[model samples]
Target: MSRKPIIGKCRLCGEIKKLTFEHVPPETTFNNYSVRILSGEEVIKQVADPNNPPWDFSDTKGTIQQRGRGGYYLCGDCNSKTGQWYVPEYSKFVHIVHSALQEVKGKEFGALGIKMKGIKPLSIFKQIMTLFCDINEGMMGDNSLKDYLLNKTSTNFKRERYHLYMHIHSGSVERMNGIMVQFASGVGLITLSEISTYPVGFALYIDKPEAYNPEGVEITIFSQFNYDDEIELEIIIPKLESNIFFSGDYRTKEEIENAIQESKDN
Candidate 1:
């Protein structure tokens, strides 16, 4: 018989805490079954093509794929608190989308003229996104995140921007699709290149710098593997000089490396 994963000290408080399942992308975004099975299958197909199997498959079949562990162990209190904290903020995010769709015009394209305009949802979303990014980066031991708003901060903003870009460009209602796919499939790692191709309809610059120089803004991605564990990926995005913008998805590892190489070349 197989032994169950053990619950020991809480990652946050270090108490002898009870273990419960936690979803990195938030379970409210997708059906549990779809996240576990269908998304798992998709990842398998991507990584384990029979014609070009670079890695051994026998050991991977029964075990959960590396990418599929977006959801993992958590204590009840942490889980409940995360839900309560993000739900209202997520709802506000939806409202911002609604307002943007209703009021934003073509002439406003590529212009940073769009303001938050007392939209509490956008403000709250920004704050929560910042917090989530900080926690994830802290877990990864990246000591570069000093300014949350001015510098390249967190992966959550990148993911959120990717979703918003998709909704605007593809006319698709699957705003949370990429995040759901990552969470369900255990593929928390993504690069800038992958997201750049995600059919974004608007221009987005997350924590992009205000001026252009040799040391352009650096964009980084991070994710929670288990409740306490996390990972990071970095990419450098140039400062945008024009206003015409379109949004898309986040990048995968390969894509991120490709972007970094391209930046070096430039």
Candidate 2:
């Protein structure tokens, strides 16, 4: 009988004894309808395949089949400990934000309208901001030490922070507006490009495509709101380096203008 070859060390930790397979994006989040659509099932299935999976997908030949499908290896230890940031805690945080938004909407329109008008509106906005901020801090915080031969030091701590910031300021905000429109009526449409341009126009550039070195990708945000109470948000992250595309929706044109003013004030 022929013996199977072992794949090398863990990406995060350089342990030589037993390497655990890790998912670039956690598999638990992959099952969602949005994720499945965004990351096609064929791509997922190919990643999950035992024999001819992607380099980021598997460890050993037979070991891949042993793990069934959906997940890769990390020995026993790294598998258990890796990627805590993008797992249950992040999901829980998103749920909290959604719940808070619901509570805001449940109040009488008159009270809610008043809340949105005055300085006290800062209090409500603060609550929303706090939840996201805490989530970002918790997930991207420093990792605990492991005393293994290759796993002694920390891994990708800075990159993880960048990812967290991108997810919050860019991804989460866009997602929140979409969820608001899905659950509530009378939300004017805003595109992702509109929102992204707001910061760019104000010269508050938090992220850029060139900074990340993604070949030729260009990202921009936009938003749109109609007088008839419809909201639409679109984000264009094109592979063409020359094209700038980003978009999202705001509650209203006044809101968008106010946000720009707020950005200036800050």
lDDT of each: 0.33, 0.27
| Ten-residue region with minimum lDDT total, candidate 2 | 195-204
Could you tell me the lDDT of residue 127 within candidate 1? Answer: 31
TM-score of each: 0.36, 0.27
The alpha-carbon lDDT assigned to residue 59 of candidate 2 equals 29
For 224-256, candidate 1 gives per-residue lDDT tens digits of 112222223122222122111111332333554
Error of model 1, residue 145, in angstroms: 10
RMSD of each: 13.4, 18.3
lDDT of model 1 at position 147 = 30
- lDDT string, candidate 2, 15-125, tens digits: 554554443223342223222111334345654554441322222222222221222334445555434322443234334433434565535331111111112211222
Candidate 1 error regions (>4 Å): 1-11, 14-16, 30-33, 37-70, 95-138, 142-266
